[model samples]
Target: MIISRTPLRVSFCGGGSDLPAFYREHGGAVLSMSLARYVYLSMHEYFQSDGYILKYSRVETPKTLGEIEHRILRQVFEDYGIRGVDFNSSADVPAGTGLGSSSAFTVGLLNLCNAYQGRYEGRTTLAAKACEIELGKLGEPIGKQDQYGCALGGLNFIEFHPDDSVTCESVPITQAMRERLEAGLVMFYLGGTRSASEVLRKQSEQVKNSKRALGSMQAMVRQARSLRAEIMSDVDLIGPYLHEAWQRKRSLADGITNPRIDEAYERAMAAGATGGKLLGAGDAGFLLVYAPDEARAQVCAALPDCKAYDVRFDSIGTTIIYSD
Candidate 1:
């Protein structure tokens, strides 16, 4: 049996600009961090039959890859020439919570397949293959940030170039700064989930049509760069940076925020949160708020309906925890 674990991600800024629709023309950059939460995959040979068995939120047994119902898994298994294995997956959080669950899954699966074949692949290769499978083969209208974030781990500043090349570098910060930043931030589950594809599809069209939104996204990319610099020196700027990013992000698409989300933001700010934003493409997901440790209680108390999730930064990317 071999088990692979990959961390999910929280995109801090530069959310929309990574989309090919935008970056292919203007290029893009994102700043994000991988969370301690993870998606795990365990696979072992199934010699009882000459077919494949898969299990996740559901179960599937297919004689051929063409018969697999899960689109991502089908494409990956076919690409890797994998068969006759019992594959099971579990995650720390559900999909569509804006934490890059899907990308975590894809990266983990790719790692598992490579390990199964007695092959070793580096992070860049793994990330690239995962991106090709999802963005190229699966045709998801998404960006490149999540795959690289999940594969590379850490707090990364990722750049997507028009030539389809990506560069990921660690955001420089002291351990003390990292700890303080993690402590000052809180994530509240606002309930419900959203389809990222639906959100990204709209945002992609908007990126091509609306100059205002496009300009906002460009400003956001700059914000991500500035945030990277600020966090290393002045940690206090985190909150205001999040505030600025959220304001620009909501303008990229319509459903990114609604009345309820707006009200929650107001309440959080009133309760002591200096700044915050929806973690993913919005609509629904965890709301990440920045406040001093002393103010977290007030923020939590103000949003009595939401649950505060405790998480820290993860430095390890997609890894095989067990192999035999």
Candidate 2:
């Protein structure tokens, strides 16, 4: 049996820019950090060995590689020539809640498969393979941020170049600053789950035609750069920076924010949140906020309808937790 775990991420700023539609021409960057929340995958030989058994939110037993049901599992398992094994997956947070859970799952799965094959794939290659599998192979209309962020683990500034190349650089932050960030960062479950594809698809289409979308995303990339520069100088501009980015983010796409999300953000602000943004492709998911010590109570109390979480950073990207 082998199990691998990967941390989900919170995209701090610069999101829409990572889409190939924009980045392929103009390049893009995103600043994000991994959260302690994780997605885990476990694999072991099946008792009967008549077929392959897969367990996640649902269960499946497929006799052949082509018969595998879960798209990611099917792809990864087939590539690794996995069969006659029982594979089980689970997560710390529900999938598609905008914490980059899907990519984390793919990364964890890749880690597990590599170990199972008695091969070692470093974090960068693991991330690259994930992007290849998710975006290249699966044709997911998403950006490269999540895959890199999940695999690299720490706070990072990820860049997507025009030539389809990418890079991840750790933002040097003091432990005191890290703790401050962890304490001030708050997340509220705004409810429901959403597949990022539709939203991202729309955003990508707009980037080719709408200068507004492109401009907003480009500015968000600058926000990421500014944050990276300013963050190291004993300055915490994250809250207000998020505020600025959120303003631009909503304008980049139609479904990025809705009435309910708008109402919640307003309420949070009224309760003293410096700034907050929706976590995922929008519609529904968690709303992340930065509220200082004094306003934390008001921020938590104001959102009566949502469940809250304290943000903790994850440094290790993906790893094999147990094997026997």
Cα error, candidate 2, residue 246 (Å): 0.8
- Model 2: weakest 10-residue lDDT segment is 228-237
Q: TM-scores, in order shown?
A: 0.98, 0.98
CA lDDT of each prediction against the hidden true structure: 0.90, 0.89
Across residues 65-111, which tens digit of lDDT does each residue of candidate 2 receive? 88987899889887788778888999998988899999999999999
Off by over 4 Å in 2: none
RMSD of each: 1.0, 1.0
| Model 1 clashing residue pairs (backbone) | none
- Candidate 1: Cα lDDT at 187: 92
lDDT of 1 by residue, 199-238 (tens): 9999999888999988998999999988887788877798
lDDT of 2 at 74: 86
